[model samples]
Target chain A: MKEMFYNRPKPLHIKGRVYKFGDNINTDIIYPGKYLSITTEREEMARHCFETVYPEFLKIAEPGDIIVAGRNFGCGSSREQAATCLKYFGISAVVAESFARIFYRNAINLGLTVVIAPGISKKLEHNDIIEVDLKMGIIISKKNREELKTIRLPSSVLEILSAGGLVPYLRKKLGVEQ
Target chain B: MPTIAEKILARAAKRDQVKTNEIVMAKVDVAMSHENADVVIRAFKEIGLKKVWDPERIVIIFDHRIPAESEKSAATHKRIREFVKTQNIKYFYDMREGICHQVLAEFGHCRPGEILVGTDSHTTTHGAFGTFAAGIGGTEMAGVWSTGEIWFKVPESMKITVHGKFKEFISAKDLILFIIGQLGSDGADYMAVEFHGSTISEMTIASRMVLSNLSMEMGAKVAFILPDEKTISFVRERTKKEFTAVLPDRDAQYARSLDVDAASLRSQIACPHAVDNVKKVREVSGLKINQALIGSCTNGRLEDLKVAASIIEGKNVHPDVRLLIIPASRRIYLDATKAGYIETLVKAGGLVLNPGCGPCLGAHQGLLAAGERCIATTNRNFQGRMGSSDAEVYLASPATVAFSAIKGEITEPC
Candidate 1:
């Protein structure tokens, strides 16, 4: 078992296609308040994910895709549903300039990696295959065969990602029964 | 050497001082959600998370947009039913239950000296019970759902002392609004505000809940009243649970201490675009309103409803103004109905909405159109926060909102 929650010194390689977005992507836009009562099934939620913000998101999203967005992504309501819907759809990670405090914490706690990459959203395009080297803070696009950018993660958040999430990480560190 | 919030957080995390911006993993004693469970479940599957760290620690309430206002909302609730069953999450409350904050308090979910986080901003309501509670985003909630632990930054502290006795019709709501008005919306930004002094000690738990619930409107990360006899009695009556008292050390320091003289305060209003844009009701008198809403976790208590009923008895709402009254919870609703408060309000031309968020979130019922103006008891009046971006929301006390409804404009309770 992992003894503590700490990010690996070496990068975890991520291979995925990118899904681009604009600023102020709120929880209501991610998973509209209207569909909040629907089932938690992955298929059910993935269908409605971004249904309002980008009506064609469901049709275009492929497994192992990445969502790149502008600042203040997930700005309203601490609805964990926004993160859940994205994870349900098999998205690999979310890279944005900034995120609402609660949404940022929720994403990391659930074991879904979210990186803060300032200005990367402006350079990215939909369906752009990229490799994210989290440890190294580097993004390399396979489509263009070029280095897109590098973004750093705070040491604390890196620890969370390394530990797989708060529960397992804390369990190991506290020596508690899991 | 830890700050007060740090000490409590450390006890929960079993650590010493959790430094600023440091991610210290700690178990979540309580995780509350509202009307957003479907997306949370979907996140669970995406990560292939199988079980909650602790099901009993989780609370899923369908309060926002309740009554399945639309076909889409209905479908969301349907999804929640299935998720709750499959997970056996025992704390789930259906639409008929009530708002999460009120229900949580009534059901003994909030306890003193514990750390709590909700997916709703009004989660600060738990602080009235003396817990350190704040709101977080859905993704972070998903993280808590999986691991039951969250990160934190030990915040600085601010002590707000309310001295003097309140005049007639002045309430805890007025006191809080007055404080925000003086300090500005971001006055206590990212700080823990501890409410102290004799007047704070005299307030009922319901009234204290109103005070802490709106602390978020002023951008406070945490707001709590000191645990006292009233708090003890409330916990004892509600949960039969015993707790050791937690108080700040006499020598403990605060970033600043704000002294509010309640005796000199009148009912106040937080104007549009910002909660800190406060003015005395008399200062804003004659500002006509199209609606008056009294509800939200902030002021939806039986006491609040009773106050409104008292002012509206035998007096109809302004014919030009639409008045909406909603209790914070179904229990409060039923109690108000049983006591004839609901009838009194209805007879006085107030529309009684079933217990839920209602107009507070601007989803259904009582939303204002462009150029409309309303006096509300709910927290937050940011631009377009209530309905159309062009509409204006003036935040005030339940009494003030009721009085305004009758007068058709902002007015002092004479």
Candidate 2:
């Protein structure tokens, strides 16, 4: 079989409104266990996304909004609902000081862009327009033009993200079309 | 030089060796999910794949919210059953099987030197079998179900050595809680913790799982023990398959090493709000509690039930306290019942629940009310973990939970 999908990394350029949260923002608070049994539909999960912290979030959230949080973002539980809810709500990307390991992997596999910029939490303000440049590993406060450097991801990960997650990447590489 | 984690990952990746911080696409020997497998099934569907990469390598168990607590859950379970059948997957366990992690180990799905992933944080429990087992998310699990290969960044190893003898009432839960208190929640963040020394080698298979399970609370990606004689005997008795033990090199490199004098450690407990907030049982002896629970993937095995039964054998639970006992698996429930542990607990005013993770995640059963306090053997004490966010949860060993039920307070086991 001829290789259809090659390991070609594509740089991402994301511009969105910002939503700020604090450190140790756990999954239970993001999507409670009570809702785990109820439903996992994107709309249903997005309705309750961050319902514990910001009950009015989904009502006010616009597509391409960015979520900025302090260290240990997405801590607690290994539920992919956390990433799925955000992706379904049309979140452009998530920039955090750090993320729990499982959540980081989950976000990548689900095609949700996550950027780690040290001290990015201190520079972000609620409702600020943030521009994420994956090629340069820079996240800028568009209004203030404040630039924050992000850790460059492995090329393989960037390829997967550009292909819209691992599943699609696998499909493309295997020469399978939906 | 590679640590035990690196060696195992290297082997799985078909590489001679792997270094710390290096990423490798390793083959998965076993991957699992519970009721949450519904999400995994969905993600796999979204993959546009006609079938799972290997049906036999995938295991799905229904343990959380068993017997379908609500119509929505029943529908989810129904979908999962259909997915299992459609995929021709053979490793499906219904609600009667018990907790997912316990079932995986009990049925010999976890083996030495293999890499495993599950959709539950306590999947770390299988590390007791010398496997590099860690928790992932449903989407990643779906990716594994599609490819049978997952990428991993070989983490730095934190070697924890526990030596000397433990006190009669001191269990693995106490030891792990003490270690977590010292290291704090982020102490082992994103690292692989290797447990060794005489204390670990001497513990039973069930006891060793306690250490690995709670290691997640400290933010460890995985916790493993080098396979030994106890491991061999446990696997041999439960499975007829021959196995090779995975051990660390004499000069295995570790990022850090911590020593614990097990004999000096006493009954430890984690107070409300934080798993790393530790206190001695004597310090909170008089603090009143509204409920006491003895179960979870952490400490719901036969050994734990026996200890709880021995403590509350002839005594009654406090009038103000409701004691709940849930066996981790059907096998354990049957063994405990056959040994009269279940009857003894029920006789002592305890309410026995079906074999499953009922109250641990607070999904259903034994939920706490506002301003209430609970002493439980389950891991994690986050707010609202059981029911109401206003309620407080204290984490302890099975013996402590049983004794506290009798005292109606957080009490030390006699």
Question: Candidate 2 chain B — worst ten consecutive residues by lDDT sum?
Answer: B236-245
- Residue B93, model 1: Cα distance from true site in angstroms: 1.6
* Top TM-score hit: 2
Q: lDDT score, residue B267, model 1?
A: 82
**Each prediction's TM-score versus the true structure:** 0.78, 0.95
Candidate achieving the largest lDDT: 2
Q: What share of the true interface contacts does candidate 2 keep?
A: 0.52
Q: Model 2 segments beyond 4 Å from truth?
A: A1-11, A53-62
Encode model 2's per-residue lDDT on B134-244: one tens digit a residue: 999987887899889999988999999999999989999999999999998778888999998999999999999999999988889989987888787777777766666
What is the per-residue lDDT of model 1 for residues B211-280, given as tens digits with 9 covering 90 to 100? 8988876667788888898887787778855555567767766888999898998888888756778888
Q: Rate the local accuracy (lDDT) of all candidates.
A: 0.78, 0.87
Chain A TM-score from candidate 1: 0.83
Residue range A50-119, candidate 1, lDDT tens digits? 7754678888788799999987676555656677688777788898877655667667765678887778
Candidate 1 CAPRI grade: incorrect
- Considering only the true interface residues, what is the Cα RMSD of candidate 2 after superposition? 3.1
